[model samples]
Target: VAVFTDVDCAYCRVLASHLGGYLADGIALQFIASPLSSRGTPTYMAAENVWCAVHPHKAFIKAYSGGVPAPAPRPCAVIVAHDSQVAHAMGLPGTPGLIGPHGAVLGGYLSPRDLLARLRMDAATEPSP
Candidate 1:
């Protein structure tokens, strides 16, 4: 699944917290950075930092689990801006916008179990390989 997420969104944090649940159910998440804050803001910078981190997944987890510590404001050649543009183009309403394997969009927060159920339903309806 691909998730359009904002680092500072509370609901995004909740979804991130249950990532383990999704993983346990064999769901692999592809996180796309879509900062809610405008450019040059703290939130945007933090999102950039996460994209630039040596371990982006770990950085993202740290950011949502607690708070992202201030990192040196260095220029990042990351895809955060591109991700934001793509999310906007997709007409996503807000953070935690989930794109399922078959391109189904599930906007807003869903518990891990609900997500797994939805995915399973989708899989059941797919044409066999």
Candidate 2:
């Protein structure tokens, strides 16, 4: 599963903070930081700064969940551009959109229970001989 999310959304934070639980359950969860206009437009500037910082991913996760923003931007421009391009290609118009292995797009915030249920449904629909 690929999670499209913004750094500023609490729901997205919850999902990221709890990623280990999903992974422990044998679920492969990949994240696509789909920073929306509300956050991306300005907050992404902060993200860019963090991207330039020593530990981009850690700095991002920390600041994203209400921590202090990083002090400086990193030297890498490609990561920022590439992430934006991927988000645009996926038709991601908002944050917290989830894509399954079969290309199913699930939008908005979902409680862990609901997410598990939906994943189960998707699993059940898989082709098997």
Candidate 3:
């Protein structure tokens, strides 16, 4: 799944806690920062810091796990901005927008089981390449 996420969304933190559930279901997550969703939130800076961390993936885990990411190695405004633009172009409503394998965008929080079920259904209906 490609998730459009805000680095510090409370609901996103809840979802992050279920990472094991997602892994058990054979789902891998690709997190795309949506700092543009930072209207009333404070995660925009966190998003930049995460993206610029030496080990960005680990930084994501830390951020979503309710821990602060390490300081960025370099300036990261551009990449973070680009990610937000891509999310906006994809029509993501807000943080935690999940894009299934077949390009279906599901919004908000879903348990791993629910996510797997939806993915399975979508896959079943999609034509094989």
lDDT of each: 0.85, 0.70, 0.82
After TM-score superposition, the amount by which residue 78's alpha carbon in candidate 3 deviates from its true location, in angstroms, is: 1.6
Candidate 1 lDDT over 44-109, as tens digits, reads: 988988888877777888899887745735667357888998889988989989999888887678
Ranking by lDDT: 1, 3, 2
Per-residue lDDT tens digits for candidate 2, residues 9-124, read 67788877777677776667666655565333666666566566787677767776678666664455566667767878878777677888888876666656677788889889
lDDT of 2 at 4: 74
Error of 3 at 36 (Å): 4.0
Error of 2 at 118 (Å): 1.2
| Candidate achieving higher TM-score, 2 or 3 | 3
Lowest lDDT block of 10, candidate 3: 35-44
The C-alpha stretches of model 1 lying farther than 4 A from their native spots are 70-74, 127-129
Backbone clashes in each candidate structure, one number apiece? Answer: 0, 3, 0
Total clashing pairs in model 3:
0
Greater lDDT among 1 and 2 belongs to 1
Error of 3 at 9 (Å): 1.0
Indicate the residue-level lDDT of 71 in model 3. Answer: 75
Query: Distance (Å) between predicted and true CA of 101, model 1?
Result: 1.0
